[model samples]
Each structure stands twice: as structure tokens, then as C-alpha cells.
Target: MPFIEDFNNNHPTFIKNLLKKSPGLTQREVLLCMYLKFNYSNREICELMNISNSTVDSYRHRARKKMKLKRTDSIFSYLNQL
Candidate 1:
């Protein structure tokens, strides 16, 4: 996917470390995390991914769980740290 290529090109190290840290994450989840890292809102992600708002929420929740994030943790912060 173009978005994947773009992200990979722009943030190669972050992507590598993220995959190493959470190997179980699906491609979609990784993509979601990238978007969150860039501070994309749910509605923006929905439009960009051609998915519904609820689907975006689900992806966020699942990605958070896979990343072992606490409930109070910010996904943006977690991704940025990675």
C-alpha cells in the first residue's frame, strides 16, 4: 500500500522497533498506530482508511491491547516513544 510505503520510508527506525516490540500486531494495526503517532484524529483516519468511526475505535483498542498499553496511556505517546 502507498501509505505503508510512505510511512516506512519516512519512519524506518520507528517501524522496525515497533514491529520488534509488538510482533503480534497486524498490518492494519501497525498502520493504525502510525496514524495515531502522526496525531491523526479518528474521523481523519476513518476517511483515510475508508473505514467507519467504530472500526477506527476497535482498531485503536485492539492495537492498544496488543501493545500492552494501560487504560490511561496515550496511544500517541506510546507510539512516539517507540
Candidate 2:
């Protein structure tokens, strides 16, 4: 399955680390992380998640912050741990 393929290729350590750092993120924030890391845009995320554009944006920001990722940092740095 595509999900399995994606999961296998990407390490979960980054997400795990982020989750450990920020335990207050809602389910929506967690889902946003999965979608974003998998290369989904906010619009696509909204459609797939059945949520609003604003909600996706908000969740993305919250997820990144919850993960302790600096705003000035590139998203690629987060993937390096994999």
C-alpha cells in the first residue's frame, strides 16, 4: 500500500521527537504533520482531511511549533534525523 511505502521510506523518529517535545497538540495537529511530511499541501490536506483551509494552516503551524522546529529552519532539517 502507498501508506506502507511512505512509512517505510520515512523514519518516524522526527515525528516521535516532536510529539515528545509538544504533547499538547490536538489530533488535528498530529494529522497535519503526517500530511505535510508526506508532501501534502494545505489545500490537498484540507480536502483529504475534510477540514477547512484555515484549519489546515493553523494545524500546520501548531504542529511545527509543537515539534520544536524553528520557524527559520528548513523543513528538510527535520527529515535529516531519518
Candidate 3:
């Protein structure tokens, strides 16, 4: 996985605990969560992941849904709390 190595290297504990808490998350979703946890902007995420803005938005929405977050909930705050 392209981002997995960087994510694992930079945030092994967060990724591990996130998987424990939300094991249903896919690897890509975990990567999105990791970026959000770091307060990365959508533009930054898009640039780093070499994806489109819409793709980043889609990932954020999917990740939030998978995490059972409310529409108004903050993904960053939730991940930080985890």
C-alpha cells in the first residue's frame, strides 16, 4: 500500500488502536483517518495521496460512516479521542 508504510511509520499506535476500535475500516479508510487525525486539509490530503478533491471528500464521508459518526461529528476530534 502506498500510504501504509508512512502511516505505520508515523502513527503505528494510532493506527493500531483505531483498528481495535473500528476493525471494519479498510486500509485506505485508515489512511484517511490518519490524515484527518493530523488535521490535514482536504487539499493537503489530495496532494499527498495524489487523489482528487472529490476523492478525498468521498473518503472522509465513507470513513465517517464506517466509524458510525454523525453527519455533524468531527472526524479529527473523534480520532484524537481514540
**Candidate 2 residue-wise lDDT, 13-32, digit = tens:** 65566567678878677666
Candidate 2 weakest lDDT stretch, 10 residues: 73-82
Give a tens-digit lDDT track for model 3, residues 1-82. 6556786787668877888888888877887888887788989989888899999988878888888899888788899987
Consecutive 10-residue window with the lowest summed lDDT within model 1 = 1-10
| Highest TM-score against the true fold, candidate | 1
Task: Give the lDDT of residue 71 in candidate 1.
Answer: 99
TM-score, candidate number 2 = 0.66
In order, candidate lDDTs are 0.87, 0.68, 0.83
Off by over 4 Å in 3: 1-11
Question: TM-scores across all candidates?
Answer: 0.89, 0.66, 0.82
Off by over 4 Å in 2: 1-15, 79-82
Which of candidates 1 and 2 is the stronger one according to lDDT? Answer: 1
Preferred candidate (TM-score higher): 1 or 3:
1
Which ranges of candidate 1 are over 4 A from the true structure? none
